[model samples]
Target: MYILLALISAIFAAIYFYYKQSFTYWQSRGVPHLTPSMPFGNLNKPWSIPLVDQVTKQYKIFKKRGERQAGFYLMTEPIYIPIDPEFVKNVMIKDFHHFTDRGLYVNDEAQPVIGNLFFSDGQKWKNLRQKLTPTFTSGKMKMMFNTMMNCTVPLQESIGQIADNNETFDAKDVMSKYTTDVIGSCAFGIECNSFKDPDSDFRKYGRLMFEENAIKAMKFLFSLSFGNLAKKIGLKNMEPEVAEFFTKVAVDTYNYRIKNNVKRNDFMQLLIDMMDKDNNGGQKSNFLTMNDFVAQVILFFVAGFDTSSVTLSFTLFTLASHQDIQGKLRQEIKNVLKKYNGEITYDALQEMKYMEQVINETMRLYPIAPVLGRVCTQNYTMPSTNLVIEKGTKVFIPNWGLQRDPDYFPDPDKFDPERFSDENKGSIDPGTYLPFGEGPRICIGLRFAMMQMKMCLAALLKDYEFRMNPKTIVPLQLGFGFVISVKGGIWLNVKRIS
Candidate 1:
């Protein structure tokens, strides 16, 4: 018993000493840092709050300390958060080569889902990004516009039913179903019919993909704290079930498309064509395997659907909350549609300048990705500072904190779309307003996502008026998850225009 106790004591002592050394990393380097708690590092409880909120809180703390750059430990790992816009510009653009990889938890061999463009790093990400960039261009989007518009037919009809019943519904769920159907048709070349059948597998699996239960949440936190160790133990970035479901769906879809000799002007077709070329030994500038194809499709479906749905839902919620703004936006949509003969087209969608401003403002208040992360690819010295960020150091750009800063955006809490008006937009700083991020590694699907949101908003606003539902919690409390989602959903009541 004494021998066992001694061994246990030695193990604990080693761990404690190691953590002490690790926690002193930023301090030794002459960097301001948040004082870290033992075992959990800077976080008192690793899972105490939602990840988004935690990062935002840290951003506020570091900003209030009057520091341009500060460091904090997630467990033993040091993460650098840059508060200055100049520093953000350097990291995102000028010195981007030194900060290429997102430093996300990705283990393709262990979890194929992480092989997607979002998580993959180094040359793989570059190649995949180059290959997929053209897939979302204006011409490509125009080709897929009809398919996306078709999905909105069901969206309008379903929302019309709710308006008829005079019942409040979860706008998030409703918007998600519309996006699910859009992604199903556009990304996978299949009909989801989610509006007609809410329990469709596409909707179920998509919801499950984003669902953050306790166990999965803990695992995600663990991975963030101990990435190398987590990867060693084969800890997946996605839930096992989510990874499995998406992988299967990707594979089945690919096989079906190839077997049927299917070709459609959508994301899935582009991926399939790439795979076909590789199989046929055609010109191989950037050949894609079946796995790569599936990964890109899944990335498009997951990232595009969730973020856009949340954006659309929040736009509606905010519009409902402020009836005057909603009226103004609805009027703009009405005027734009009249020019195109009551038809919502890509051209008409773009003409709703005020609606675009509303989305911009909505995103500023509740940016889909509250914090963006990058890992140092090589040792980088700040241009004007003595601080040297070591290779492998994780860097965070606090999207929420920066966008909500009163200095950049006066009266930040107020939902004011004029802040994004053409006259006012030019006054905003270059790097201060990155709803879709900045630089080469910026979101490739920005055009597609904007197109999706515009069409849905235009269609909905043209026919129906919305107000906040009583079931919703006002002065909204955000969910503490990867994305900025409202807790208990953004409930809204709809009324059909006579």
Candidate 2:
């Protein structure tokens, strides 16, 4: 009886202390906020809520306080959100070294897949980034252009098949198959033919990585809000099978290429070249191990597959919603391709400025990762506010919310490529646009994703007109997973054009 009474007393004491600590966060600074609940701080019931919905809720709370920035807790861990773009830029770019890490690190000893480029930090990331930059250069991309286009032959034919069948098809699913083939061929140096085989290995694992499931959703939320705690609890951001299969594919491919004197123009060859160059472990060219080689290859496949798939889906979504814009875009494609004698070339893609604007706008609204995170390594003060943020704090750059904020973007939801036009693009602040993030750690695969997207769009627009099907879930809800993904899928119908 005394033991039970002691346990109840301990629980009450913990809750009371949590409330006191949470309330003191804003009160001590003379900032205003709603009273926070015990233990959970201001986020008492966020466990089951969708990420977008949670951000929207937090946004409303931040706006209500009328402060440029405010402190909140993700389960007693203090995190700061900068309501001003200037402050956000300061944290992300202007004074970046102090806040270089993304606040989320996985122990490679336990989880090798989690230790790849998107998650590694410090000198390891710097060295890896330097050694791999050449892989994405315009020269190297030129070498792989044919490999990328090789996937499009299947995509173009598949779209034609659907239009001929006269049945409405989900653009997301169709585009997923297309992108799966593109990444499979380019990254793995294998022909997946996702278009021909719906159960392609790449397609299967791609779905596993991003599908809305309880384990994945909870893992992501906890990882973002409470990194150490999540790690301690053994939460994972990816499926174990994904890592095993991709690693095996990369290792076997590299070994096969070495044994048979195989040479290809895709990303795998570049990995091989980088490994050969960086044997001595210099800062510019560090030692690349067998795992490092496979990690890069696997990361290339994992990162490229879903993001390109989603971007293609959003590209189709925006095009379908704006018929006039679609007509304008199609006309540009027709004119551009005609100049090339109906062959899509690297030179021609660069000339498609309107298509660039369209893609930029799609990324603007439906960024692949709607949220970004940074961890505080040391105490840093905000230049504008002089508010000292202590070490061990987490920060969230709400790319999803900030992009949609009307204060910065008028009629923010409208799909207007002209907003990114040369005339007006220079006028808007650069950091305000962070679809690919900013400063040192922005996405390394941006160039590849853009090339793949542009080629797919060009091939389709040159051939068909797409419209939204009633079957598509409108105002697309995000899939409940680590990456910013849409739920219920994006469906559309295509009309063949002469």
Candidate 3:
């Protein structure tokens, strides 16, 4: 027993000394950093505190100290944080080549769908991005507009029923179902009818993707910290059930379309065209494989539904809290639709400038992706600084902090859409407002997401009035996860507009 105890003690001592040495990396490099603790580094109470909150907190501390950049550690792995907007611009846009990859764990063999545009790196990402760019073009968005509009029909009806029944409902849940239906119709060429059947497979699997447990969280951390080892052990980025369900859906959709010669204007059709080498005349050497097609499909489904749903839900919550802004937005929607003869057309949706302002403000306050992560592809010196960020160093842009900073946004916490108005928006600094990110790697689905959100808001705000329900927790405590989410959900009461 004594021998075993001594051996264990020696091992723990070695680990302690190693961590102590690793923690000095920032200090040795003459960079400012927060003190790190054992095992988790600077990440304190990671399981309890949301990463966005932690990053934002660190950003505030460093920014307050007038530091342009700071360094920290995530489990002995050194991370660089850019606190200055100029630095942020350099990392995201000006010197984007140096930070092309998001540094996320991707194990295609173990989880085929994990090897997606959002998670891919190097030449693969560049090539895939080139091919996928046209997929989200303005023309494609125009093509998919009608299909997206069709999904909103169920959304309006479901919300109208809740309004008539005088019931309090979770706005996030409602918006999620609406976006799920939209993504389902647009991405998979299938009707999810999420409002009609809340337990639909699409909805079930979508929820499973975001549902966090201790095991899921630990697995995520492990994959992030020790990616190679995790890959060797066959760790998955998502639940096996989710991966299987989405993969099967992709295959089934592809086979059915090919067998029947059915072609639609949605995303699936475009992917099918790219994947079918025979259709491509067998000339394109870089044509998409079955795995590639499914990966992209899953990416679209996940990014499309979650980001838009979060934005829509938060916008509703914000508008519900501030009736004046809501009223003004409703008037704008009414005016735009009036011009189009009460029909929500693509062009008409674009005319609702106030509606756009509302959405932007909500995004600024509660971004779907609170922190933007990138990896240093090569050793590069930060412009105007002596510090050299080594290759493979993980960098984080505290988007939540930057958006909520009082320096750029006066009275930052106030839910004011006027900040995003044409008159005031120009004064905002670059790199500070990154709801869709910036530069080449910015969200490819920006136009699609905006259209879907605008359509939903215009449809609902035209006829229904939403008010905050008392059941919603005040001050909005955020849950610990990758996406920004409310702890108990955003509850609201709906009433028909007279």
Q: Rate the local accuracy (lDDT) of all candidates.
A: 0.85, 0.79, 0.90
Worst 10 residues of 2 by lDDT: 279-288
Off by over 4 Å in 1: none
Error of 2 at 201 (Å): 1.7
Off by over 4 Å in 2: 15-19, 29-34, 60-66, 280-287
Residue-level lDDT tens digits of model 1 in 21-105: 9988999988887788777787655555666666677878878888888887887889888888889999998899999999877
The TM-scores, one per candidate, come to 0.97, 0.94, 0.97
What are the candidates' C-alpha RMSDs?
1.5, 2.2, 1.5
Enumerate residue pairs that collide in model 3. none
Residue pairs with backbone atoms closer than 3 Å in model 1 (clashes): 37-41, 50-480
Off by over 4 Å in 3: 1-6, 277-287
lDDT of 2 at 495: 90
lDDT of 2 by residue, 1-498 (tens): 999999999999987876676667766765444566655666645656766555556765686565677666665566677767887898889888878888675767666656677778777787778777888898888899999999899888888988999878877788888888888888889999998899977788878766776655556656766667777877665678887878888888989998999999999988887776666453445435787787778788878887888788889999999999999999998899989999999988888999999999988888777767887777888886757877777777767777887777789998889988999889667656888889888888888888999999999998899999888778887663555665667778889998
